[model samples]
Target: MSIMALTPPPIPRDGPLLRVDRLRQWFSSGGFMSPRLTVRAVEDVTFEIGRGEILGLVGESGSGKSTLGRAVLRVTDLTDGRVVFDGQDVSTLSKRQLRPLRARMQMIFQDPFASLNPRMTVGQIVGAPLRIQNPGISRSEVEARVGDALRTVGLADSHAERYPHEFSGGQRQRIGIARAFVLAPDFLVADEPVSALDVSIQAQVVNLLMEIKRKLDLTILFISHDLAVVGHVCDRVAVMYLGRIVEIADTRTLFRNPRHPYTEALFSAVPVADPSRRRQRILLKGDLPSPLAPPSGCAFRTRCRYAIPACAEAVPPLAHIGGGHQKACIRDDLALQPAC
Candidate 1:
């Protein structure tokens, strides 16, 4: 690797809204004398999102995208590393300390169906954050905030009176969005927020989210597998493989001039809009390997077509290629085809 590849990306002197430093979330199973197996769901991941910026994380089902998202939000116990949010070292905070911090940082869960409390009315669900964080706020203030959040997501105030079971899939997600937005958080981890909704409904939700972001100037970490949706909403994109971020760059650069083989393969599968144009899909031979026993060197080397013997020597760092673009693969000669 060149010296440039060994060098780390410079953080903005002013700092970002959220900074994840070498974040790792590992799960252990099968104990005692049998030798415990550790699933490195998110391993040594690092990134930053500026104030009002939307950073997209994309990968297949088990690539640890959601796990990374949760780790950043501190929803699950992290095995190692640190998470700094808006100048605060959130990873070091106790549960009691993190409780009040929830108002500034929030998450919009993926499954609208499962995330909402079936028994609670929409108002109760949306107003829960405010009630918990700002104990001094009056009930009327909570109701007002709930109404505003609902209307912001295109829901009526009357809809807040109904139960989750009474709403359609789209409406339930809107309620979820309302709940997350009720705080008007400085940072949002939207973990596949629109994936469970219908395609038509997904478009509406995406539009609403973008609109809200514009109005509120919200900083978001959007996690999703949908590249097309990501290309539309994200300012920058990060691609994950197994438990590592393989590549990351500005949306235009990453989409039009992808640097990693895994990114090339993933983007090639994206369907085109015009019937006249066809994309040559980059198909790998094997399925994604289990994180329990991930391959050494480069975890993607087993399936990466551009893999060299050197790829098996040691894991490549997420190195800066040029112009804010970073790739983990060490090879410098391959000119992989762009997704666009």
Candidate 2:
């Protein structure tokens, strides 16, 4: 089944389920005596995830895709910016104030083994969230919910008695998914959930996530470095470079015609299955620059093939090209045809 066909409708313009405006997440490195340095993990990033939509956050390992996902869910404190979830600005909410909101938002971490506790059984691991969130609920109800959640992710009640070490990577990931969904959260941050699993298991996890999203009407921020996976699962994709969003659009449009050079380079790397089709790989030069000292203007200008003098003058804004597609580059002459 085509994952795109299962995607829910676009987020209504009147109000989005989640809104991130000018989000910046900077980490302070160095001691008080040493020169104070700032690592811009995420900067000036802004986007929206509509209700029941899967928005893919695709980028290189250090491009801040994971950090952006965490920041959106307020898992990490923002350096500067606003995160409005369900019409409330969650950025300013205190821990006590944010307690109730925690039930509505959850995260499925990247590492299944690390995220799951070896000391606890699958039942304990999955039901932990419920025990903390709804303390008044009886043990039978929590166990029933945990069983239901396990079944939802394709695991059985018998599997809940097993420890994390007993199951394979894929099954452990399913446990993680069940834990995240135990609260029936409206928003979920799946940070590279399938990246560590076996190639054969990746598709199963992706399909399970798609099924869960559709069945529960959940909005997800799916973060991954794999463009093929992102293209297969997401409705809309936001391409990140260094610490900023370089391009964003619906899946079909972005795949057919990418505007940003960074995005083009990324799309070029996706392996094509057809032997007859020849794809021209756009080779990006140099390693990703250090976030502590990024380029003055566009961070990607140094590696961009079609970069111009204007690219060094100012950080290009994400301007509309056409059809709700937006790019951050200033150049307009370059044509980057779709490789796939």
Candidate 3:
């Protein structure tokens, strides 16, 4: 069997690369122009990614997946929570203090075009961090390092002289990857890295990322709204809804035997290549509730077909079923066995 097919099934507590606990980020609208409401971008969300593991974060656009990723990296402030990286808390770092530690964690943003500066050459863009981090390093060493990073991401050393707009979408993303990886970051946060690329090009980028992971022995947090892509690259998957993680499991387990209603709905919505063999897609009713005014208990209850009256009254804690599989659902009677 292929490595994708033969790998042992994922269990929740097997191990974690990064651990997040009760994370919350609340933004209060200010002034008369604002609604004077608090937008809870992330609320009491928790999960972990095993070392050298690809833990996919999947959710709808407003589901707070990106926000959670940013918060963990301490790119944004947190309202309440703890982000433990290799057992060290990241939330406690001061601006001046986070410098040395910043080298270990890096992010690949969704919009490659926007993330890169048009004014700077690719070499300068990639080498800038190195310049700041290691001022004493010689110019020749920086040039060599930048060239090596470009080659690692499959771009030629010559391409380092070009600007971001000069390359194709896929190539630009590769540049982003090159910039992020040049630092040799231990944990990489890819926020929808492939979502902006052409469908034909997505696979190439995905494969490149996978290859780099193996060669570099790096751990990654691959965030995306597409289940298909997540299935391809991630070892485990976490499904988020309305600022909270509704369910999380091994990648295969999530696809084959989704335990939570939200996860099941997601799988049901995926379109199959063959129209004749299509399973009925679960169409969620009503739009996602506004984060400023989320439902009291289960945020998904308003749209969940299996939601009960009690679901509206009590928030379901993520209860452990067995074998590290967990779900936040009151209806244990309907839980599906995790995929093997």
Question: How high a TM-score does candidate 1 get?
Answer: 0.94
TM-score per prediction, in order, is 0.94, 0.94, 0.92
lDDT of 2: 0.91
TM-score of 3: 0.92
- What lDDT does the true structure give each of the candidates? 0.91, 0.91, 0.87
Which residue runs of candidate 3 sit more than 4 Å off their true CA positions?
1-15, 31-35, 274-278, 335-340
**Residue-level lDDT tens digits of model 1 in 76-157:** 8888999998788888777898997888888888999999999999999999999988889999999888999888888899
Query: Which portions of model 1 miss their true places by more than 4 Å?
Result: 1-13
Instruction: Enumerate residue pairs that collide in model 2.
Output: none
> What local lDDT does model 3 show for residue 332?
80
Error of 1 at 160 (Å): 1.8
